[model samples]
Target: MKLGRHSPAPKRQKCDHWSPCPPGNFAYRILSGGGKERTATICFEDEQLVGEPGSGINIAIVNYKTGEFSSTNFFHMWAHDHSKQMMDFIRSAPKGTLLLMATQDDGSTRLKDYAKELVENLGSKEIKNIKFRSSWVFIAAKGFNLPDNIQREKINHSDQTKNRYKGWPAEIQIEGCIPRNLM
Candidate 1:
């Protein structure tokens, strides 16, 4: 475990008290107890621009033990056409699993374009809109960190109301950039 911290090589795939890797690294992990947050990283490692420098990876943890969802964000442009592997990794999670994904709104066609890739590549039968906060978007499995009633309210609306959602996240916008605070 200590070696991970001292390795100075690159990223860690798993987490332990000695060596803790963040949520986005494929080797990221949690403590021995199930109560700790658990995460799995999804990477798009290609020559494509999305996988290039200045890009980052962030995963929202679904600490089911606590029934809470704390989100994170990474702003990067995805120039690829599709990512079937990423979609499969997301869908592979158990229904109650609180797996989440988010990215900053870069104010470009590429953002929506990558979103479209998700909608098309997803293998799940159920359909749900991604959550939008200031300048961010969230995609998660059904029943992911939401109570049944609130989740229903969100689902009923085609687009987010102009008003803010819980004073933080708002419904996602299909065009234009997200507000400055959101970014």
Candidate 2:
């Protein structure tokens, strides 16, 4: 007599199946000189699986005087590991290099920590040169509660401040030169 066929075992689910996985590739477009330009996706994975995405955040440095610009995006972990690269980009920035923060509330803490770490690693000397000199903008999908201390300090030191766009949740706009005067 023939034996009955056995069914195959069910495959186990991946832990990250439900988690939001990083995008397969990152895309960016640069607009300069009244024209639009597109760049290819920096490959995040390789055939050998030896390489991964460079970073999760994008840094754009625009040289207003010459109208030239350069930008690169890095994986979140790379920010710490590649401090020198980050510093070099910052140091090489030309006048009017704007530091913009665009992220959802879920990544706010990471963004804040990255900013703070950048400030700390760049050292007080470097920070002094760029903190107020650079324009800082924070775009959020949802309103974030700013701690009283942070609010007070920002208000006390920042030259200009604006909050959320009309009908928007909690977008914060901070402008003006650095408030070095704040103690």
Model 2, span 94-119: residue lDDT tens: 43432223211112223344554654
- Displacement of the residue 13 alpha carbon in candidate 1, Å: 29
Say which candidate scores most in TM-score.
Answer: 1
Q: Under the 3 Å rule for N, CA and C atoms, how many clashes does model 1 have? A: 3
Clash counts for the predictions, in order: 3, 6
Clashing pairs in 2: 54-75, 55-74, 55-75, 56-74, 56-75, 132-178
**lDDT values, one for every candidate:** 0.30, 0.27
Q: Mind giving the per-residue lDDT tens digits that candidate 1 earns over 86-151? A: 444445554554443333322122334444455434321122343232232233344333322211
Which parts of model 1 are misplaced by more than 4 Å? 1-58, 61-63, 66-77, 105-134, 142-145, 148-183
